[model samples]
Target: MTDMASAHLSHDPKWTRAHSIFSAPSEGADVALIGIPAHEVSLSATSAHQTPGAIRDALARYSTYSSAHDVDLRDFSLCDLGDVDSPDHESGEKKVATAVANVRANHKLLIALGGDNSITYSVAAGMWPDLSKIGLITLDAHHDLRDGVSNGSPVWRLIQAGLSGKNIVQIGISDFANSREYSQRAKDAGIHVVTRDVLRKRPMADVMAEALDIAGAGGREIYVDLDVDVCDRAVVPACPASVPGGISADELRQAAFLAGADARVRAIDITEIDATLDTPDQRTVRLAALLVLEGACGVASRKN
Candidate 1:
């Protein structure tokens, strides 16, 4: 606490290097998590651009290295590869594709904390090598399953990357502002849309059973895209498409836990955190940290 607040102390690259998520790193960990704040996005309501650094700073302050899993992520080589400069939309996608692809090759799990949903498209480009057997799980209020032009749609990129039609499942979709045409297109394109209504009805465990049946039935690799809009309006207000009713943070935590528990979830990304909008989200930062931590924990749990 003393070191974190001092000016010279506040910006020490070594402390930043040791604990911050932005240190340039070599690849060799049980799981590789990448935090790329995509807030420089071209859309409205995507305040995600500012989230990466904030989350990293919070983790450095609030969390610590643990060896409980017999693998300390801190002692292990998990480096924050720094933010890809996606000041431009198309170029941002390109950067994400390249950074993620490079990490995907060496690391068992690839996770990206994004600036917007656009990061998803790029991550899919980087990770969708085995299109014949990839499973996508998106926890969002809107079904981002678009036909290459769904507004900020990442699922289109996965399909473009060659992920099969039957391998994508969208959880937590709300009908508030989602397009029916787009919904039908998503369904026709082989994306299973699990409604918010259904999730509300059953226990998260049951939802996992269904998601596993839909996505992991055939030993498919998993990609998780978490849009903060899936959270209720107040909890994560940086996203532009937030609706009246949505999943609670507890629901999201459980969903992430469930996703991590799946054996074939090869890579993960948490997106749509607009930092500029979330002026006072110490909790959001904490949530993102836990999201990444739990993600790693999930992979560790699987290995154990």
Candidate 2:
């Protein structure tokens, strides 16, 4: 990972724009962004820990293509705190918790670049210390309300950790093949399920506002977790349990826009990028990179 990260222009004269916001708190700089490369996990996206490096590479090209980020990552205060080196999956929960705790402690909004959905559990565990009430806004094709580990089933574990089901506002549940029991568990627990049908019917803007209201119910620590599979397979690819009719990039971006606009949202994660399913040239990392930029810009705009 170090080798790949070194290959990128994390620090280059022309890329000074990206570095302007990439300041470090260790340097006494108030960094608004903390890129956590959490790659050790049980799901496909967890492998994305290694992908942020690729995203950096892609960002260099993208920023050069557009004069926007070249103007100092859009003039945002950010930093790449680097990845959490966790090798074992069984111990992943602990490692991610530590990494996220550090990010939270730094007072930087965590842009958790993932390896899988499992990392969300660790991120939540870490942020639990500072968060009094938390709301989960999960944008996925499937409702990950399982009770145990079954491929990409970290959301269930997150709920088990006491993240109130009622506080969760699940959007773009384009598919829910789990079971009636699973649906009842989340519903019984008070989790709000905003189906794609409903989302399409209602104003996306109002839906976000309502989601925020639900998420804000506890106290406020909005965790946005996105599994690439949640997106239309056309935009991405197949995952553990694949599905059709996923959310579009624009929809996800709009959601990111909402999350970023909502000051209560403290942490965000864009997970599940299968480079194997990328372009013919293997450039799938752009999706994640663009997602991060959208998330960052959203936060930057909201904070302003």
Candidate 3:
């Protein structure tokens, strides 16, 4: 076993450690995982660059088997492509695009561990430079349409880069987290908005299906961004923008799994977590790791 595998050894052979399943880069992988630690231009102060590694490390705490889905991630071919060095600037985003473009062809799904929400632009850009052919779904607490190159502005940047706003859906948008200006921008751009209040009344599965249908309209490929800040602050202390009334952790997990289960959903990125800020119980990072597994389980369900 490799060092990572050894550290996560399980007592029972039937119960495999989750971290042990992802191996070195290989061909025909079902899932390809990569780290994009881009925190330089964040709107708020964050040590989010440490999140990818923390999520990876947190995987050691869980088993590959998912009781809910009756699936084992070990049965899938997973690879870790490591991290993109210094992905906090334009040149680095290009590196992210190039790296994603290189491996996306060989994998069924690419799960990009984010430094922040900024990776959404680069990853989606890499997946489909012709943004018109792809749709976007963001599970976030903010509009992410702020005017700048920071983590809060990727959606706007992507829209500027040719992505049609009509095909974009932003869910879990909190009341105080965004400005009326950006809300109007989203409205003007034809971006669909599903507020946090609405989610409180609707089932997560229903919301996910609707978002996927809207974003994946015209049979376009979809990219889902799982920004951790969409969860309640109590659930994700590491997410600076998370609020008291945001979605529950379970809802977020369900959303991720549903996104992964859809055939048209080509890629997903988990973002906005600052590992260093997590509570003593490490709940935030653990939840992020579980989101990865839930997504993998969703992918595994495709064979059923």
Best by lDDT: 3
**Per-structure clash totals for the candidates:** 9, 7, 0
Q: Which wins on lDDT, candidate 1 or candidate 2?
A: 1
lDDT over C-alpha atoms for residue 101 of model 1: 71
TM-score versus the correct structure, for each prediction: 0.83, 0.81, 0.96
Q: Which is the winner by TM-score between candidate 1 and candidate 2? A: 1
Looking at model 1, which ten-residue stretch has the lowest summed lDDT? 1-10
lDDT of each: 0.67, 0.63, 0.90
Residue 184 of candidate 1: its Cα lDDT?
81
Residue-pair clash count for candidate 1: 9
Off by over 4 Å in 1: 1-24, 39-41, 45-47, 65-77, 147-151, 279-281
RMSD of 1: 4.2
Model 3 Cα lDDT, one tens digit per residue, 22-129: 989877988888999989889888899999998898888899988888888878899998899998788998898888886657888889998999999988998887
Q: What is the lDDT of residue 16 in candidate 2?
A: 41
lDDT of 2 by residue, 1-304 (tens): 2355346445555554342345444532233444445544454443455565666555543452223323224455566666667623657556666655665556546777666666666677677863336888887766777656633566777777677777888887764655788777778878898877786677767888898888887567688886666667666652434356766767776777577657778778776664444665443466666666666666656545
Clashing residue pairs in candidate 2, if any?
21-78, 45-115, 45-116, 46-115, 46-116, 47-115, 166-190
Q: Which candidate number has the best TM-score?
A: 3
Q: Give per-model CA RMSD.
A: 4.2, 4.0, 1.9
TM-score preference between candidates 2 and 3, better one: 3
